[model samples]
Target: MENIDKRNRLDEAPFQYRINKDQTVFIDYEGKQVKILKGKEAEKFIKNVNAAENDKAVQLIMAKITGNFKRGNERKKR
Candidate 1:
């Protein structure tokens, strides 16, 4: 989890979401400018998110999490 700044007071504020003129989904989460989707990138993001919850994918992802998931070890070809 990320640490929230005290002065921002975003810990108590509700999130605000809006779409930009270019159809980009912008989120104001905890006083942070987080983008959820933009232009053609939404399709890929939605695909991965939906895949994460699939029955077969869930099992396979859990297997990796319990076995191969690690920190600072990305890009290690296997």
Candidate 2:
């Protein structure tokens, strides 16, 4: 079997976040909302995201906030 280049898939960032006027943070994955942060948590999340050095860093932060997603048992959508 040939070695497949899976780096492209890892380069794709599926996580996104938005902050509301009331300082609530909304975390989304693949265009769907998954987590919400309010009050102190929202403030801390904003600070961390802003301090992230790159897209990959931001993705990592979002992934942790949204809980474990890389269990290796996820099936690819056809």
Tens digits of lDDT, candidate 1, 1-78 = 023232432334434445567666554444555446665765443354367654444333222323332344545335
The TM-score of candidate 2 is 0.79
Candidate with the greatest lDDT versus the true structure: 2
Query: Residue 1 in candidate 2 has what lDDT?
Result: 8
| Cα deviation of 58, candidate 2, in Å | 0.6
RMSD of each: 13.9, 5.2
Tell me the spans in candidate 2 whose CA falls farther than 4 Å from its real position: 1-10
lDDT of 1 at 4: 23
Location of the lowest summed lDDT over 10 successive residues in candidate 1:
1-10
The per-residue C-alpha lDDT of model 1 at residue 39 equals 57
lDDT of 2 at 22: 96
CA deviation > 4 Å runs, candidate 1: 1-13, 40-78
Tell me the TM-score of each prediction against the true structure: 0.30, 0.79
Compose the digit string of candidate 2's lDDT tens values, residues 7-66.
444257888888999999999887889999999999999999899897777877787788
